[model samples]
Target chain A: MKKKRALALLLTTVMGLGLLTGCGGSGSSSESADSKDAEEGKTLSMMCIGTTADAYMEGYQSIIDSFNENNEFGVTVDAEFVSNSDYKTKLTTLMASDSEPDIIFTWELGYLQTFVDGGKIVDLTPYLEEDTAWKDSFNDGMLDQLTYDGKVYGIPTQECVGTMYYNKAIFEENGVAVPTTYEEYRQVCDTLVANGVTPVALASTPDDAWLVSQYIQQLANGIGGYEYFESLKDGTGKWNDDTMVQAAKLFQEEVEAGYYEDGFTGVSGTEAEALFQSGQTAMYYNGSWETSNLDNSEYCEVSEDVSCFTMPAVDAENAYISMGSVDSSYAVSTNCKNVDAAVGLLKYWTNAENASMLLYDYGRMPSTKVELDQSKLSSLCIDVIARFEEQKSLTPWFDRVDTNIGNEFNNCGVSISNGEDPQGIYDGLQEYAQSQS
Target chain B: MKSVFGNKKSIAVFVLPAFIVYAIFCLFPIGYNIYMSFFDTNLMEKSTFVGLNNYIQLAKDATFIKSLKNNILMVIGSLIAHMPLAMFFANAIFKKIKGAAFFQTVFFLPSVICGVAVGLTWTFIYNGNYGLLNAFLGAIGLENLQQVWLSNKNLALFCIIIVVMWQFVGYHMIIQLAAMRNIDSSYYEAASIDGATGWQQFVNITLPMIKPILKIDAVLIITGSLKYFDLIAVMTGGGPNHATEVMSTYMYYQGFNILKYGYSSAIGVVLLLLCAGSVVLSNKVFKTDDTQM
Candidate 1:
């Protein structure tokens, strides 16, 4: 009887401890370790976007390593790298829990606005004003996207515009040239299909729905120009506008006509890119950040033959309008123990030497004004830079405009790809937008 | 020892630790979740109290309705697959069929592999262009039927349901088989002696003997299907325009993707209630007296 009572006590205690430890696993351990480290000195923690598959990861790593070795503050920075696809979910969860890193890789505009509104991100306008030289180093209007209500919350690292990357060898083999008009683009796709070639490598999976939506938005830009996008952003536009429906219909036609590879809707972004890199498809449309992947011999089988052109306009008058915005940006989280160290690290990352290294080595276009050294750039990078210079106005992705409406728009894009009517989809989106307001 | 055991203080001491842990980890979080469901919150900002507004909006939300329907379909699909089909396999093995041991291991293999791995494997099999399914169809001169399985919104859910069914049939079979084995051998021997054939013996001996275990297994299948998440998340991600969205995945999307924590918590509440309701309904339907078991 005594043994039975003792056994019951032991079992209860063990189960209780198991539950407590499981529940507290993410808390007590990290808190004790972090406090211990802080007592010694400052250790700035950062979370940035980089994955093994990204060609620029090496450049990103080298920059971080150099900063860790040479920073004058004697502060050692610990950084965690999350892949781009999972970064948003990870960051939001961390922010909600008040466990976000000191510095975070963030998208500009609406993506950062939520955190700014929540008071989870530190306002960097005062810091910028104090360092006039550092503030002026950035290009004109680059900081505007990261600014909300006259307060800057992030530092821009790179700039990107969408470009149509094509395999020159495939084009030569198929006897097709870069189309300058929407009609000519359709002709080229038709010709490619007639010759048994997949015209575009596109991904329409849920995670990569943004990629599909960007293409449709690009098409809409051709039909309605920069003003259409601006109107949509400012809430004066209806998603069910004629130009938007037309673009969706046109995209649907392409999908049905086999302009994209079969089973493209199920393909992931990386897989779609690989299809183009392996020379299975004639062309691929994505952001200029893909310049590195297309130019890197290790990633692309036909790297030498890969070249880019601005996507042809649906209306020739709106030729230079494009989809693009500030690319990589880093913001200081309000939870940081040392805000100055985090800012110092951002400055170090955006310095001219590092920016140039990233530009020349990884094909990342710096947001700062750096003198172009054409001789060192890959041909694909040079073409992308030229295309960037030609854009009349660059509209950022819809998701970066407003996460709520933009996410719905992405889902609508997938539905459009799956043969749903554009009119009903857009009507629902308009209703959702109105309801939110 | 008896005095110690009999003491109320000792009893409280023995029970307090576990009770405290459960209250903190499980009970408190549930209470907090219910509280948060009435507010519009991102959890980072000051949450605004909306008082049943989230639940009201959920009622009119098409995506939520679609997801709820999908979850119901999943429950029905799992019930059909895990019960009758698993019983057939279990009875076959229990009767000492040829290579029963080998067949059991083979059938049980998929359930042990991780859900993510199972999802990924099935994705490859369903891929349209170079997938095994399409290739097999082509070889058999049925190329017209080779559609993109997961990309087709109408068919995506059924494909996922088939995979779920395939993955867990053996798990339920093993449970039922164990219950069948627990029956006295003399019952089957007596049935055979009474001029009962193999089928007769099975219906008389195995069927009634596994009733209690079957009831438990039914509850497991129903609740497990209602909360199914990882497979859908890893495979379709509730896409082809939300055709494959289940309750759990939609809850995730609302909570994390769009930062509508209040709305998501409402969905979570609905899910919890439905699961509890199902357990109660199943208990009543499968009610067997303790003496009978």
Candidate 2:
């Protein structure tokens, strides 16, 4: 009896300790989350990219806090700031577990399409039709990227165009000007290299493959227009097509010419950004989403001199089209308990006041149709706005349009950079595309 | 009947909680995973049975094959390091150098540090710009040899293997050392009087005595290397076109990155089989005598 009692007590103690640890971990996570969601009657969870150290968090948190206090739903909002690279992995894991946030930060196209097709996301078409003001507030066809078979699954919060963020100070020191065409861009790179500056900063890690691919995508758009992206999607345009081959060949030649920083294949996105910001490189080719990063005094020693330009058209007849897409999007999960509160938060975020705040302070382009108060825009942002207004057309980013195709293309870019034959890279992509169908 | 009931009651009390925990955590997941592997389920959606399609497709997956090759390379590398090299260290330490205890602690320290920290430290040491390896090369007038060690596809897996070998050699060494320490000193003392050299005694007595421990070590080295995740993940992230990808990392990529849960589960089942096969093979190789002879 005594031995049995001892064993039983021992098992009980072990079980009790295990339960205590489990509760403790969850309790701490919840405690840290409490201050973010403290409203009495309503609460919504918002997920976004970047760590706490990022300045974008400050602007995003303020927007959430203001939404919580002033919204009619009286719902407080909690913002979970996942690091940019880790966010997609975490979101996919959460989605798989059916534990996705009420409103998740998502990308458009094939990314959200999986959720939409899986029926894990609520159809927002009814919500849009119910509110004319909400429906009309967005730019025409802005929501199309988030649509699948005529059903809207998300609302894009910002518009991003891949542009060449250049250091004006570097250009002035080198006695060169910003290039506006394929030939001029090449000449600019050649000149920058002669003057001892890496002409472009590009990180080629698989995660940052999108960065390299976007430049090629933009070049492809200039060479063959948006139809190339669609044709590639439909399996009609092979990755080894003349236009793609030309773009790959050009990028390779430039890389060989020392256009990018030395050992860039080994560098990460943060390191590349740092190199550009510190004036080691003459240009940083990235999306407008990085505008906030460029404008930050800490990241850039020459913040005031940092500016951007669209990659010039490779073929003048096609004109310089850009690779762009709606930025971070908001989606309501099927499991959302309060649909109205979620939509209200989305509606509130896209309102002119918040849109303007996002644009002016963070350099995030607004998806809404609201006219920007030019006086409220920074000079760096004003230039990007002008470039966006002047573009002949905009093709949604390849990755956002087709996730599988986009990832393969990005991998192809890395392979091409590593001196792999363009034909081999394209053949691999063609094989992958065939398998997808 | 009473004896059986007595045994049953004691067994029930002792095994009930463990059985319940195992069923909930392990058996349930295995069953669910097998079911899941037959479907196109994305976790949020209704699944449609695809039968053996995931496995059939995996046969043609070049990336998966590459990952399998990487896992095999890791297993071989670990076997070499953990078996012979670790045993050599164990024997040396068991003979009791002046500071054998101190050296054992020093050697085993790296294994105790979390894999993430070790990976991070090695990453810094292998960094392109300011790495210790590059600095050493430069110091020795081999500046031309300073390539980005982790980022180079050809060299990345080898670099990871070196770290794996370093981290766990000490762990296996300690295991073998403990077994060596357990052998009675009477045999060694008698062998020494009979004109046996240290190497001869080690071959005659130590090797025979530690066969069981060697079997256990072989099983551990094989399984541990096959499922190794943290160091590889924290270091290169199986990148530069999946150059250093192992089955475990590729499994994660398929399930998490691509959202192909069925395909990922198929990979998981393959890994389980590989581990089980290795254990049985090791047992066969190290089969012991039935008699005390």
Candidate 3:
């Protein structure tokens, strides 16, 4: 009896150990999750818009290292770049779940409105008011886009405008001169087509429909102004108005004219960009954010020969306004346990030294109004920034301004590209916008 | 009392762990998902009690209706590939042809590969720029027939379905082959002595003998395709404007992308009901008497 009892006790102990080990598995996953929060002795996590594959991450990391070595707050900053397309989804998910990183890169207007409404973002008005130097550090009217209900929600990191980046080498080789007027732009494309080179590389894939729509929106803004879109959003103006219809018809004309590549209706943004970078296409209409891509020697063959010009106005009288906005500005999340540290990092990042480091290394335009020494700036970047500053007025990008109907509007662009009637596309978008309200 | 799982109680105790595990991990989530279908929820926010608004909304949603039609077509495709075609292959192998084992392995190899890998390989094979399909068509002087296989909205779902069929026809063939091997050799021997043709032996004997196993296979295939997720998720993500949205992918999109958790739960409920109904329908179609065996 004693031996049997002893054997039973031994088996029970073994079983107990097995159960204990099985229960321990859950503890390890939780530990790794918490380690993300605990690892920051002085490190602040700044979520930005770029993927690991993007060349811009290496440039951003150097700035982070510089900040770690020298900062008033004695905190090291690290940037985690979520891809541009996935960034908004990740931010909304993280914000709703109360797991947002310390500082978030955000778009302006209604794109950031949801976070403000949900009380998930910190009001930066008091911070701006206290630091007059930092407040004055931004260019005129830059802060207005980031403010909501008379309170600031984010800091504009870089002012961006969409422009037609042309291949100077290709144009010079083909003996085609750059266009100065809207009519001249069309004539240049006509000449390029006669010479057998694709004039513009436009991607019409569903994911990149925004690229085409942005060009249209820019054309519309050049024809009208911000008020036209605002009126449309507020139900005062219709998308099927004469101005929009004209823009759509012009896009279709360009498509039929063989100005874009043969199979561009299904081509993706990267593919179009690749064609442009390979110098097969003379022009690529994209944002200033793509400046880094154009400058990267590994990706762009004509890096040195690429230059930018504002997309010409449909009406010569209107100041040439292109789709411009604050590119991926920074905001502090309400869920951040250490807001002061996050704000400090944001301030450090936008300051002259780190901003210039980012500019020189990554070709990023500075958000702060500090003057860049011409000697240090790339000639192409300098020229682009000069044009960006010269604009009398900057209309915020169409998609960011109208978050609720933006993606649907982009989809309409795709449908139109794929041979759907423009009127039908606009009608569908109009109905969707109505449903949202 | 002795007949009440006597001498097998320890075995039962050993199996208790697995039984409890299966019940907790599998059954509970399905039950909870059904319960969630009645409410309107966003997962992170407060869920409202909306008796059947989600269901009502689902019925009216055009995207959901289109997805339902696509899923029905997918079911027919799966049934044709796994049932009749697989049976044909199984029957051919059962006749002890030369290199039957080699062909069996060749057929079963695709089923063993991960779905995501198969999807990626096929995506390349269907690519427009330098794909094998385009090259083959071009070589045959049929260039006009070539297409961007996975991009066109009308062709994307069919492309995915063909890949699905190619990937799993072998698995079902193996299942039917197992059932075929179980049939007594005496039956075929007796049929041969009676001057019955080979087709007659197969139609009269092999099929009826494998009816019960085929019922199980039908249930497996139907449920498997009903809740399919990974291949479509990796290949297209139901895009070129939700053209390939299946019930599972749609449920994921609503839950994750749009944050419509309550609506997603409603989709989950419908998927469960469809799967359950297919099982019952298959059993009725393949009705069998245990005493016949």
Candidate 4:
């Protein structure tokens, strides 16, 4: 009886300790991911946003592998990637806790500004000034979003503009050409609908609300021009601006016209993308980032027939003010052990050799200009690149402009998709924005 | 050994470690969260102390108000489904209804399945296009009834409540069933000898006997409903413009999504208060007699 009692007590104690350990697991999540055979000072932790599921992970990994093998910093750049959906929340948690990795994949403007204001990011102006060649390599106005108080804190690796991808076979079957004006775009969609085709594939779920907002903002860009966006970015504008209202009305009209796939508000971004990739829909309006997905025959059912054009402007004068911005921008955290090595990694990633390799192998558009090799480019990529070059003005996503307000704006887009009155929704947004501040 | 288990020093030694663990993980965080609620903080910048302004702001915040209403509705829904419905099932099972074991296992099965997995299964069932529910409606010539169940703000909360009902009814049934089983065979035999009907015996004997367990169960149901998060998070993410937003999800949105940790903490404090308030109210409502079987 004594021996049995002792054994029971021992078992209970072990189980109790196990329970405590299980519950305490949250504390050890930030334990460093080790680099094989690399000593303490030789490894730098980096966090990028992608998962192995993404097609571009291959291109991203190749860049990281090359950097690890050959970078001048002699540091092994170990990267951990969270999926796109979880990236913002994870980064915010890390930022709040001050446990952010050395380098982070960041959105350009307001997203990075939150960290900059918190003094959580390293100011990269001095490094940029030291490497004039690397500084000049980036396209004009690309670094402007990352600049705050005359200090640039982040650098762009890729530029992406929203483009309307279409199925060439479906267009030809319906005898419709790529639309060049808003009227023509409407007519093309009208024709597709008349021919029993779902004109566009769009997702409006809350998780994919940005997809809807980007579309509406694209329409707003065409109608309101660059100045309207500038006004909104600066505090002279409101969410209920007449231009925004008009743009939203136009979007609703399109929704009523049966120009989008049925039950789009219930569709996820991936499901909407799949509709276009599988040739279930004629048009897909999304970022240039989707080029690689469309370029590959294995992923895209209409690979040979996929082509893109910028959605035509509502008022021709505001032609090139597009839903476009620098994507996959990298920022060094104040927590970085070695700023030099981090900046060196950033430079190596954006440099011409790797940039062109990514563009050629994957469809990532470079922030730096690289001489195009026509033989290596897919037709779809070439079309997207041409549409990208035609953009005379670009508006970064509203969420990227101000993370909190931008998020609410995305929610407003969801409201619009659900057939809510745009005027009332925008009014509510204005009230929300005021309440937040 | 001088009755070793009765020794105070040994008991304290065993409990101290667990108490410390609980204090660090639970008590400290709750205290810190309550402390943070008075400030307007992003958790990164220097936080400003606004002294109840966070709670004050929550009153005017439409989304938070909507979430609070949703939480109340969820609690009511859970009470209706888990209490009487579970009692009915438990009573039937206690009567040894045919296939009682199989039905009991089937009913208890969903609670064991993770919330995320259940949520995903229901999402597919609720999917607007090609969902099982829509297809069934169509097959029955009710095509007009087909709508995006989750995306429609009006129906979304109720739909999720139905899921909450489905997932936990069995577990609650088992709890009530256990209480029902604990009733002595003698009471029913006595009641049977007295020519009492089954319903009469249950009303006087079974109910009074299980009042204590039922009281505990009511508290569990109410508090669980108040703190519910996962299903809402997984299914719609408190969305279609947060129509289904509950307190816990709204707290997450404020803290993690927008980085308004102070406002989020205020929501957490409200949820905690609601849970505690419900527990006390439930205790009052379920006054137990010393009617042990």
> Which candidate, 1 or 4, would have the higher DockQ against the true structure?
4
Clashing pairs in 2: none
Q: Compared with the true structure, what per-residue lDDT tens digits does model 4 show for residues A253-302? A: 99999998888989998899999999999999999988888887767778
- After superposition, candidate 4 runs with Cα above 4 Å error: A1-28, A32-39, B1-6, B291-293
CA lDDT scores, all candidates in order: 0.87, 0.81, 0.77, 0.88
Span of ten consecutive residues with least summed lDDT in model 2 chain A: A21-30
Ranking according to TM-score, highest score first: 4, 1, 2, 3
Models 1 onward score TM values of 0.94, 0.93, 0.88, 0.95
Which scores greater on DockQ, model 1 or model 2? 1
Report how far residue B110 has shifted in candidate 4, in Å: 0.2
- Better candidate number, 3 or 4, judged by lDDT: 4
- What clash count does candidate 3 reach? 0
Tell me the tens digit of each residue's lDDT in model 2 across B59-89.
Answer: 8988899999999999999999999999998
* Model 3 C-alpha lDDT per residue in residues A12-45, reported as the tens digit of each score: 5534543433222111112234445435545566
Which candidate has the highest DockQ of all?
A: 4
The residue pairs that clash in candidate 3, if any, are: none
What is the full ranking by DockQ, best candidate first? Answer: 4, 1, 2, 3
